[model samples]
Target: MTTPPRPWPGLFISFEGIDGSGKSTQARQLYESLRSGGHDPLLTREPGGSPGAEEIRALVLQGDPDRWSAETELLLFTAARRDHMERAILPALQAGRTVICDRFADSTRMYQGRGGLRDKVDALHDLMIGIDPDLTLLIDMPAEAGLARAKSRATDEERFEDFGLDLQQRMRDGFLALAAAAPARFRVIDGNRDMDSVARDVHATVLRELAPSS
Candidate 1:
């Protein structure tokens, strides 16, 4: 196995899933739960976590779907992520605060990797951003259901969603494959249930992972 990145004092947890799998909701709930328990936790999202990243996000998410090629999009995402890590994530982690992110490098692997860019994505991640979340919660569900939920959101950030259900199905498979490849770092949660039930499971999983080692 590849050597992991240097460790930080703070815990890093990331939530990932197909759009509308409720991963974002779960991430926010976890942040609130931790904060209510007296933990200093920061809740943030990808492609726009920092000021510079938000600018890049607009470039990536809005405008013509064909405005940029897949490779260009990958580069933009990487640049934004780099800014996010240096300006936001690393600072918080070094200060001993837990960080909960809505999405991370895995999204790049699944979204852009579909066009034979998987190896490139991995290489860029290793070279530019070497850190991985200590725990990753993948909210798994059927693509059709996820898409339906996503469509209901009616957000301006519809670039990815505009790809439609077929692409979503492929992305779902890719996410599962990724989780299977890194079982220790990943917890696959069934996201087809009620919000409260899913939140309970997520909270429990997080607590188990954060428990002190004997």
Candidate 2:
């Protein structure tokens, strides 16, 4: 007799947003909560998941314009992601752990494709869709407000962070469009509210989708 299909035990969740959108904070909190509830959840960030990816992250986040370009930025991100998936994320998922990524392909789609270089965003997005997240939580906030929050935390900015407000606005719009297009996979959380409220919303969404084992 033919065997029935086995249930997919693992889940993949991704957090995405512009800088200062509070994604990292919520991601960590969710990770802790999931672990406390007896679930195997691995918390990781994009551009820096594996050892090799971490080095690439340093180059991407710590460079000046002279050392970085739009194409270079996009390719470096892809390289890190490829390694991370091979070494970290895919294995975790296969082992029945919830893989929570702070950022994923969406960031490149927003930052490099939409905000910086509009020509290659589609191809990049397609590359990511090949191995997509089971659930993607998009923390949405105003570009200006996010920038203000970002500046308060750091006196300096990175190469990508130095982009103009107009570009940031475009990135926000791009994220919104993505969420609208993928209602099943993307949850758009209103991040203009306080941090606790945002986390609550994100947590609620996760519970609804994952129903975390007791």
Candidate 3:
């Protein structure tokens, strides 16, 4: 079991899914919706939210897909995440601002675990970054659909997306398993729908979390 972080006054939400599941789009939409509704929300992304982390992002996302061994990549990601937490996430939460992150440790668990480093990834996360999001929205979809979508984007950040369809299917399954393991914090949303429909579900989920408990 993963240890939770100390209690925080602000809300922290994260999005997780296979590459190209439209999780990023939904996260941005939620941020926009929150701002329009007069809420102060900080939108950020993993491995690159803070200045130092962004540098690490290029190192991880660029280069040959096999540039780093699984263990080495995990270390780099952990270092980046630590910097992100210290510089960006922690401070925002301390100020009582909602932080919507595009991806978090779950991505590491899924991606690295695929390379037979599941135990190492979990241990590193528990030791260095025990913080879990208040809510994680998993955008569920078929791997093929997601891969098609991701390939169309054609960004230089193709290291992960280029892993092919088989890996993506495994990742999709891995994310669902993680959600099943932690049902309370994970909301599995159907990502096969239209953008507006998916955004509606994401928006509703965040609103419920933000609502005052009666």
TM-scores, each model vs. reference = 0.95, 0.88, 0.96
Clash tally, candidates in order: 0, 0, 0
Candidate 2 pairs with clashing backbones? none
Q: After superposition, how far is residue 117 of candidate 3 from its true place, in Å?
A: 1.2
lDDT of each: 0.91, 0.81, 0.92
The CA lDDT at 92 in model 3 is 94
Per-residue lDDT tens digits for candidate 1, residues 32-100, read 999898989989989889999999999998877678899999999999999999999999999988899
RMSD of each: 2.5, 4.0, 2.9
lDDT of 1 at 208: 78
Candidate 2 residue-wise lDDT at 13: 95
Q: Rank the candidates by lDDT, best first.
A: 3, 1, 2
After superposing candidate 3 on the true structure, give the runs of residues whose Cα lies further than 4 Å from its correct spot.
1-6
- Residue 60 lDDT, candidate 2, scale 0-100: 83
Best to worst by TM-score, what's the order?
A: 3, 1, 2
Please provide, for model 3 over 28-103, each residue's C-alpha lDDT reduced to its tens digit, 9 standing for 90 to 100.
Answer: 9999999999999999999899999999999999878899988899999999999999999999988989999999
| True-structure RMSD for candidate 1 | 2.5
